[model samples]
Target: MNVIHAENIIAGELNEFEQAIRLLKRLHECKARQYLDSWCKRGEAGVYHNVMRKLDRMGNIYQPYADHETEITDWFPLVDCIADTAVYNLKWLGRMGQWHPEALASLTAYVCEQERLQAKEK
Candidate 1:
């Protein structure tokens, strides 16, 4: 009976730990999205006939999708640009060096370690 009670305590702790991990990951995901959105905002140009021509020099800066935004008047055109930007930023961030699983694992480990350290502080 004592062993069973201990096991249940462990299981409950694990569940709580898992929930904390998920919440941290969700917040990180939201932060990453906001980062991408900020980058995308830089692409948005006013509707002008010479906008693309003027923004042509922006290609030298190696941004995510400035070219797409030069002419984007609606949401449909942005889909491909955002996808490309995500891939570009992922590569730029060194995430391409490791696959998705490894990236996720590293993020998870970082979050877990931070949580552990933070809990120790309080």
Candidate 2:
């Protein structure tokens, strides 16, 4: 468990909601550090070219990384897309009203199990 989880656990226990939230937070931290953050340091134009190469058909959405100095311009849509993606997740919480407790318990357990498997692989 990370500091986030350790700080939240009280008397060897955490409420389902808090546990699930912390688990997802941990998952995000892992992905951002191991994968997402490295995208900008890879390939020809780095993150820009890597993503645009795959999104060529969409003329409006994709732009070639011509000027490496202004790479931040190419990364702008990513921030916009993140906000859109965050809003899209509202449906899940909206649907899990009455089943939140058990659902969160399962979510936390599933994340912990996956982390264990991933760590063992490493």
Candidate number of the best TM-score: 2
Q: Global CA lDDT of candidate 2, please?
A: 0.50
Q: Residues 9-120, candidate 1: write the lDDT tens digits.
A: 4544456545444444454476667665443333323212123433443343334446554543554334334334443344334442343467667777899999999999
lDDT of 2 by residue, 1-122 (tens): 33333554563476666665555565556665666545445432453454454344333343344434334456547433442333224323433444366886787789999999999999
Q: Please list the C-alpha lDDT of all candidates, in the order they appear.
A: 0.46, 0.50
C-alpha TM-scores of all predictions: 0.24, 0.27
Top candidate (lDDT): 2
Q: How many residue pairs clash in each candidate?
A: 0, 0
Give the Å shift of residue 101 in candidate 1: 7.2
Spell out the clash pairs found in candidate 1: none
Screening candidate 2 with a backbone cut-off below 3 angstroms (N, C-alpha, C), the clashing residue pairs are: none
